[model samples]
Target: MSTPGRGLHGRVLDTLGPAITAGEYPAGSVLRTDELAQRFEVSRSVMREAVRVLESMHLVESRRRVGVTVLAECEWNVYDPQVIRWRLAGSERPRQLRSLTVLRSAVEPVAAGLAARLATPEQCAELTECALGMVANSRGHRLEEYLFHDVAFHRVVLTASGNEMFARLGGVVAEVLAGRTHHDVMFEDPDPAAVTLHVQVAEAVRARDAERAERLTREITEGALQELDILAP
Candidate 1:
């Protein structure tokens, strides 16, 4: 989820971010910058910059002499896509995916309702196009393509809701969708019913039927939950 860590400091985060999220460094664990510099073979300056990035993410806090202390998970900005990506790759995958699906269920239905009422003509057109792209890629080992459209479709819906809070979740939703496709129990073709429901949700949004849009979105999220139970449990 991070850019390729070719930059010196970037390389440190590429290792440390996931390792911290994966619990390699538990809460309250203290790491000396000098030791980390030696281990990663980076200069002290590069290591310090990496620690600063982690601090910004609330993953760690650096002090003058106390070294870097891993923060409690509750302090982390879990919405960061990189944190989600790392968790989804670790032993925490099942739990992380479930939590994110539950979050989507709670937020997306309401966002779709708002989108139906507030979306501009241009947004409506974009929704239909994304829905069609999803349809075209719904079968025959085309998950990567379907995922592209699915993420776009939801991003547009959340953005068109006219709430900046909802709009900010687009990346979170994208990570969840990508996790489902690339890391979760989804191995076969996407559910046709889910695809159909997305198209219907788009139709309802375009028609400005907020109630219908909400209801259809609820169905989509419920189906996602059902898939987790049936496929992973």
Candidate 2:
């Protein structure tokens, strides 16, 4: 049996999510408890529970007697699933693509380096397996092979970073890849050079050559960005 809280919570989230993304409740707009409760036909307690979910996502913040207010873009949790969905749905502008690429360039190379120096043997083996699996999956058909390996490779890199904060970025990285995987750019003919680059990255990490691993990982990602035209030389 679905709990009343669960159903009411979903309705509140659905209603408020559209409003927030549509700019009906633009950043800094105050959300009133009574007004929202009446509009959604839910009790005040149920409305509060929905607001908590939004707050957790960094979409809204509660203030003493000021109620809940929409947060600025900087304050919103871009990694939040809801935020990612909204951004992709609202506008997948070139600038956003470029920004995401730039972020990956900055974070991923360091992660690779750290992984080379710190990853357990098991982690290294998993990385190699993922790379090999990718090659096999791409045989006669590229499909989503590269994308799956791409996300897995980076996820392990982050995990091997030995920093919880960096590892936490796995979700954001995965989301970015998943969002763009269906685009034509990612589905083009396989590039042997790209595949070789992945092999090189795995080898470098396996050899525990931190600098070499970092450089190779950077090259691979930068090449991808260049192919997408999201980065310029």
Go through the candidates in order and give each one's C-alpha lDDT: 0.91, 0.76
Report the C-alpha lDDT of model 1 over 33-117, residue by residue, as the tens digit: 9999999998999998998889999999888889899999999998887788788788888888888888898999999999999
Q: After superposing candidate 2 on the true structure, give the runs of residues whose Cα lies further than 4 Å from its correct spot.
A: 1-7, 21-24, 63-67, 92-97
Q: List the candidates' TM-scores in order.
A: 0.91, 0.83
Quality of model 2 by C-alpha lDDT: 0.76
- Backbone clash total, candidate 1: 0
Encode model 2's per-residue lDDT on 55-151: one tens digit a residue. 8988889888998899877777766656555555554434455666677888888989998999999999988988887677665666577778878
Deviation in angstroms for 152 in model 2?
1.7
